[model samples]
Target: MSLVSAVQVRCPSCNTPFTAQMHRAIDATKEPRLKELLIQGRFNLAQCPQCGVQSALSAPFIYHDASKSLFYCFMPMNMGGSAIQQQQQIGQLTNQFVSSLPPEERKGYMLQPKLYLTMQSLIDDILAADGITKEHIEAIKQRAALLQDIAQSQSVEELERKVKESQDKIDDLFFQTLDDYIAQAQEENDLETAQGLSALRDEISLLTRPEGEIAQQAKQLAAEREEMLDKVINERDQERLRTLISEGRPLMDYSFFLALADRIETAQASGNEIEARRLTKLRDTVLAMIDEQDEAARQSLMQAAEFLRTVIREQNPEQYLRENADRIDDAFFAVLNANIIEAQRRKDENAMKALAAIGTVAASILEEKAPPEVRLLNRVMRTEPEQRRALLQEERALLDDRFVALVDQMISQLPEENADLAGELRQLRDMAIDVRAQG
Candidate 1:
């Protein structure tokens, strides 16, 4: 797709104006993101800030898949033009696109460009490039459509019924749809929607699985350890699980091996050689499942440490931190905090200053996002008389009884020579009274 500039878009839900970045032509061979977005059916999805609503931009775009030896122009029907009418435009775009390719890379198929009037048709064509048959695509689409019905169901009974009837539809597409929404909500900091969708995903999981399978699996493990099954599988915190540690309970992950270790000890202590042998085999089976995850976590921490150092050296620490805030979870902080401790231990002044800048950025973001009234009040209380007057004038919406009273008290206590401050407070008081009266 051509690199289209940002355009102003009004949110349909809230009527709030926002800027949307859109492209009219996409070349997958050049920009991988365009391919990924088209595949996910989110090429032109514009998310609104005022209300968490996603809307698609109606625009013509060309999809160039060099890998598939295909170039198709998707001209939106809403533009009041058929594919034939836009062939010249598409031809020019295709010509420009192919000219940029190397001689060996050019092929004959690229000469005869395909045309699709609808976005959906273009997406289906793209999916076909992967060797997926039409029947498979339709089948997946059928399942994908059921997700809306499932979302609309009012009660758990209705959801459960839909889930039971549409078992065939609960495939990869269904899960992927939920996963994309979850990811979008998290990226946007829409925690309520993210949490709601997460709970729905859990419910869907419970519904789709065979009845009593969860219960049966729970029964397979030890009874006390039974409560810890969800904790381990879901990576949930199980604070009281009995494990290898004598002082405190272990994490769900370490607890599995620790519990197994405990079981081995008990078997030896009780002289149950046969049971101990079986338990060791079971422990080995469990170990196989968790080994990869443990290794990955260790590797991720090392990568995070290196990344933190790189950020300090080569990037704006605040900008990097802000852009990657979501990725900086507990593990990231653990790595960062460890470095801070090392810096302190070694009395490394420059290193400490650099690390401290990271903390300052986080603090500034938190301060900027504080509630409007709280921030206004703090500024009003601390600023000089002239500054306070300007602050009051700027924050007319925050001029309430408490604020007015505070300003009035300040005016009464100010020195006689402070006529400007007192005059400003009186004017503010009048504005507050007017606002309250209207309210």
Candidate 2:
């Protein structure tokens, strides 16, 4: 069996003290026995055990022990004292109550009643005399006991269910009171007050409703937004695809060869041999049609042909020439020569006349009694300085024999006393021999 403690408590209505067990006091509820006693007010609640006269009990009369195992009733001092003094007195009384508990139970009870009583006294002060009825105090104590029992409940779900049931009963009562107030207002023709009260009631009802309905509403809204976003995205994609197809962007052409020639060239440069070969075959097929086309068709096909040829020329020059080098070179040179001739025809008359005069003088010199080589040399000498210098060296080499003979003759003609002229002739002859040897 559990150990229990009991304390004497005065009936608040009659000011008649009586013994009440702590468990019973904490557990007091709205039972028929309690109602018949009508101990629902600080005054006129407690019954006198002898005379049965109910009288008002003063504040600070209720007391609890340290372990909260006992509640006590006592006569309090007059209201002439300061609040601090009253608190001190109550604190001493609580200390005495705790000191009276057994040492084993006193350990957990350390100063709990003092704290509870202090807080309770402050609340009682706030409520003043009008609010602190016996019924209100009893209700608070009962709620505390119910909370304790809920703590011992097996599961959170069970505890939550019980709490909800209690809250729902209170809420129903509140709504009923609000409905009655609104009705009274309406009966008095106070339309404004009635409307205000109805609006307040609606707001309170909404606040108390379950959260699942709100969550479902949010989920529906999000799903609708997602659906609209998907539709817009799909429509935009379709429009983009259509525009690309209409503008000839080649989305349908999966053939790698249909790609731009520059792309093929780049692939070839990057050593993508397979892509390069495929592109080359496709380009050749396209270009082969040019040979079968008429002039107008060929002209219309200029871009495709040029692109194919450019890729081949830049990527594989040898192959390009093997295929169309002769034809392309002939066309290029013809245009080049035509441009040069046109420029020559536009030459100044004075420059032309100067060239003609030089040519005539050259022809007359070629008519001299010179070797054919010398004639050719003289003809070249008019315009070629390098050829003139070469011919002069050749002539000097051939005259070496004559130079030696003339030097010997001049040495003989010199007088025996005129040795300087003989020395000069000898020097000339030696220089000529050196030139011949070098040549």
Per-residue lDDT of 30-66 in model 2, one digit per residue for the tens? 1212211223223224446855665443444333323
Question: Model 2, 335: alpha-carbon shift in Å?
Answer: 99
Enumerate clash totals for all models, in the order shown: 4, 5
Evaluate residue 166 in candidate 2 and report its C-alpha lDDT on the 0 to 100 scale: 56
Off by over 4 Å in 2: 1-45, 48-53, 59-78, 82-84, 107-109, 112-439
lDDT of 2 at 86: 64
**TM-score leader:** 1
Candidate 2 matches the true fold with a TM-score of: 0.18
For each candidate, give its TM-score against the true structure: 0.47, 0.18
Q: Candidate 1: TM-score? A: 0.47
